[model samples]
Target: MKLLSSEIKNKVLESMVKIIDRERHNIIKANKKDLDAFNREDQALFDRLVVNEAKVDGMIKAIEEVRVQNDPVGNVISDLTLDSGLKITNKTAPFGTILIIYESRPDVTIEAAVLAFKANNKILLKGGKEAINSNLILEQCWHEALVENGLSKDWIKLLHLKREETQEFLRNPSEPLDLIVPRGGERLIKFVKDHASCAVLISGRGNNFLYVAQDANWEKTLKVILNAKTDKISGCNALDKVLINKNIPNYEAKLKELQHVLRRANVNILVDENIGNILSSENKIQEEDTWYEEFLALKIVLAEVSSLDEAVEKINTYSGGHSAAILTEDKNKAAQFMEQVDSAAVYHNASTRFTDGGQMGVGAELAISTDKLHHRGPLGLKQLVTNKYYVFGDGHVRV
Candidate 1:
């Protein structure tokens, strides 16, 4: 892969910012076409498909944020000299080419490309058919920026392939795929993993869990739970499960209060047997599979746990390894829960909504990776590059 100078990359980003601003109307108009064609029955998917003026502004902001950040290529990671006069240095390098398959969201077409291009990696976007119009317009904006900066449009591209074609391409990609990121639900991730020949980075599934410990501040716990569950139901960090300690003070009353709060918010609740006895009117979970499901909707499951260990075990077993939180006034207990949750981002008395790249101070991100290899959390500009070693040796031979 050809290395691009930081100046040139930033120039492209600057050009992209201006182009998106100028083409804001066209972008919105194109997105309207997608929204018109989409099925509104899937509220979460529809929410993701909408690209209003605010969404356009968000895209511009994402590009600008990445533009001002430091370039992530060729930075020294480590340097050492052996006794045999051999000098070795490790430096950050781009992953060459990255393919990210995502669903519904058009903003990803902007965020993913900007991050990968700024890091000097070419990006291939395979957005869902539902957002085709939005993605096409966004891809054109990217191309204009690249061309303005004397770079190949191939640096950022959108793949327009059918389902069968995508499957075949993943199995035998026409070009080398240094890495693949499946930024969607379990089915999509599984599809990519089962077919892709390259390294696949798992992301986007979010059956996140939050624990309310016995000593948790009731007011703070309620506030965090409301925001994490409803702030943006379409978000990958949205809370799907809440485990309340059975020994908490006034457990039945608190569960009733929770049911009232959730009902007022119009959030559908599912409960385990223990919680069901208290909130009898609420729906009971029908299958074990629901525990592992990432509901990108206004739905959540409330269950009871006897101890902190049980809470931790349940989250680790059922969560998507995305985000988890604990609400507790006890510092030691909060620390224990945060340490044992085994998610990408574990929080103490904070909402799982904070797992986002922007919220976590990562600016714009490619995805919130759940994969432990290569990277685990936000795939930001700095995290996009792998490491390369350079050796300088003169008249040195290994025995």
Candidate 2:
């Protein structure tokens, strides 16, 4: 809970950047062990588990980004001198200790720790068992960085607890837990919420939706859809559902064109009743639950909407409150959809993929938060700290 000077924190991050670069080969080797032991059936999970040279470079870049940015803690929010001769100043403060439970991604082990440590919060990483080896090596790198900067290894610890033990720890944490971020699917979020006795920030689940308005530019719609859905299937910002306005010019033909494009890209499509009629050969959505599903794969759902209101309503109801987009040349409709859709990030003629932290210019993020309590979008360095009121009074007392 001690506040570290910005110089020391940046020094640690500098060491981390050099250390990660030097240990890139060993890091890749450790990841190879995880990749070999992992089941390849879940392609999305498999892709997330891979930590190649590019990923290591990305890790180094993340540290560098956070390192150069302004330290988030102690920035003054507001200062006021009351009429009663009292001075009160609200300033940013670290959250003390944070626990982030995530799956597959070993980069979170670095990104989360760097952000939290830089913000003066001790982070406890609870990565999935599948990436144990990779995370262990990454944690070792973090420890080396911390020790090199004369900081405690406890500043960035990794929790190695099993399912039942995690449940118990969540229910009755051994140490103080200021904030808990569950960065995974619904099951994982539910597990953390059901047990954790601290404030929980929801992240990771992304049943993102995109609406193609009747006035949409056909070429742009197709491009956005293709990029959002297929560009990176493992990303949480990846598009999962597409709602096309039925009144769009040449609706049936556009639908067929979309199907063709997706087919060429090897993306499997599921359609609602109306879309099913047009794309008869494609599979129809079997259950209503399909609307709420986050397809973190080469899969997407195509549905029809009669109006912009309907598209907004459907997205608000079924989406994971992550990201939503409207493709329309009409500024009015785009503004309406952007205003009405209940999501952390809403786009106007842009791909839902822009919901990412780095893409949105937040630098290295802890996660893309879906929760609305403290934050609702990218959990970046600035978003990691809460506020504290510092009061200075001349022997004043409330009457």
Candidate 3:
């Protein structure tokens, strides 16, 4: 694969920023078509599909942010000289081609490609059919920017394939696929992992958990819980399961208070057998699988735990390994919980929603990777490249 200079890539991105800014009305119109055809029953997916003026502005800002960041490729990671006088250097390199399969969120068509292109990687975008019109227009904008900057349209592509066709394509891609990232729910990740012949990175299944210790400030806990749960239910970092200490002062009263607050906000509450006995009016989870579910809606599960160890154990066993939080004033306990939980991101006295890329100061991101191989957090520009070693040796014969 040919490595593009940083200047040319930044030029392409600059062109994209202008093109998207100019075509905001057309983008919104195309999005409106998708909105009219989509069923709003899935509130999360519906939220992701909607693109108004603010979203268009956000897209342009994302491109601009990536355009200014230092190019990720060709940076030397390490330089070494062996005893035999063989000089070796390891340097960052592009992944060649990257395929991102995502559902809704047409902004990804801009953010994902910008980061990949800036790092000198060709990107293939496979968005859900529900957002076809929006994705097509966005792809057109990318193509125009590429052409204006004297680049190939092949650098950024939107694949239009049905479910069966996608499965077959994953099983047998005509071209080499260096990496495939599935950025949606469990079903999408599983489909890609089961069928893809290349490496697949999992993203966006966030059955995030928050543990409220007995010493936690009730006011702070309530505020964090409310914001984490209701701020944006469609977000992958949104809170899903909350475990409260059963020994907390006025534990029963606090539980009732949480129930009232949640009900007032129109958020549905599901409880385990223990919490169900107290909050009998709410729905009770019938199966254990509910613990493993990621509810990307206005729904949350309340479970009671007797100790911090139990909360840590339960979260480790059932969480998506994405994000977890512990709410307590005790620094020691917070440190213990943060160190013990096996997740990509852990929070102390904060909402899990802070696990996002932009919020974490990464600017634009491809996804929130839950995989530990290459990366375990936000997939930012610097995290997109792989390393290669170049060895130079004098002509010598083996002894």
Candidate 4:
């Protein structure tokens, strides 16, 4: 009976969604009863999202503004001609359903739903264990939007399940999962890539890099590294390693300055013995934390390379194929690093922290596509749709 009810709810939601745009701003403020439901049911979730409610609202407002100002990616391209008297054009279409399985990041629940909703796709969100309460709150927000607009909430349904359930879904692909985008550590994404039968988008982990080049301005380098690692140590964009040139002037003092900053921020520093002597204090970085570790906290690895070539090789070898940055005053050297390092977002004279879909000017974010295939960089609304050939022929079959 519950399954039957869910099917009914899904049909209702799909029908309503197909007609929502006719009314401008269909999602309005919720009524008193709805607000009460939000408050009373699962209050722990309220604690999580409510703490950052204003910030979430700001993101929503920004998304809505972008939705209004920007044009949709889909348009009928009808300018193809053939010598055999046939016109062939192409059209864009949305993926019908997108099943997302992500780890405990509350904001992603909202992010995925908004992106899917805007792209005219149905979404089934199954957030991992740590964010059960937080995900519930975010799911409720979408439900309110649907319910207040006189629509069913199935458009963005949250599959209430535990970690085991998600593993089952990945291992057994009987469900109608059009695409599965995994967002978490190497373990999570690897499980999905190995088990899931459907097409998958690897939102690979961030073993990102930052290089302090020989010509880099010491002051700017300090500010950039701090911003890169300290902006939000938990984010995927944060720098995991700092590569300094061995031949630079005041290298010891510069290294010491950064060490102090990392220590003050409460980050454990793993330094090579050469650079270890320069620091004011001694704090060791564990072997596990030193190599390809996304600390997501106050932590960094310091390594001294003999030359620029060595620095590039180290990054290319150890990088998680995510964002990488080089702080350098020398334009030529920066360009060289950008070209040599293999990652999705190669930044220069800037922090790797800005490697996000929203920051990259997409109205809605899907995830960073780590797999190099149909999509590679940050997945956005455009990546959500694909092309289909629309061949036009008047009384002309195959010649």
Tens-digit lDDT track of model 2 for 1-399: 689999999999999999999999999999999999999999999999999999999999999999999999999999999999799999999999999999999999998888988999989999999999999999999999999989889999999999999999999999999999987778999999999999998885899999988889999998999999999998999999999899998988989999999999999999999999999999999999999899899999999999999999999999999999999898887888888988999999888888878999998898899888889899899999999999999899889
Q: Please provide, for model 3 over 38-86, each residue's C-alpha lDDT reduced to its tens digit, 9 standing for 90 to 100.
A: 9999989999999999999999899988988999999999999988888
lDDT against the true structure, each candidate: 0.92, 0.93, 0.93, 0.69
Residue 289 lDDT, candidate 4, scale 0-100 = 42
Q: Would you list the rank order by lDDT, best first?
A: 3, 2, 1, 4
TM-score of predicted structure 3:
0.98
Displacement of the residue 324 alpha carbon in candidate 4, Å: 1.0
TM-score preference between candidates 3 and 4, better one: 3
Per-residue accuracy of model 1 over 1-399 as CA lDDT, tens digit each: 899999999999889989999999999999999999998999998998899999989999999999999989999999999988899999999999999899999999998889988999989999999999999999999999999989898999999999999999999999999999888778899999899999998885999999999988999988999999999999999999999999999999888998888889999999999999989998999999999999998899999999999999999998999999999888999889888888899999999998878988999999999988888888899999999999999988899
TM-score of each: 0.99, 0.99, 0.98, 0.82
Taking the tens digit of each residue's C-alpha lDDT, what string does model 4 give over 1-399?
011232333343343333332211222221212333454343323333232435455445534533543323355755688998788888766666788887655667766666666666678887765555556655666676677656657778888766677778777754577778887778888878777878888888787888888888888888888898888766777788888888788777777777778778877787766677676366555464467666666668888877778888988888888898888888898889899988999988888888887688765577887678778777876678656687778899773
Q: List the residue pairs that clash in candidate 4.
A: 267-298
Candidate no. 2 TM-score: 0.99
Compared with the true structure, the alpha-carbon lDDT of candidate 3 equals 0.93
Clashing pairs in 2: none
* Poorest lDDT segment (10 consecutive residues) of candidate 3: 390-399
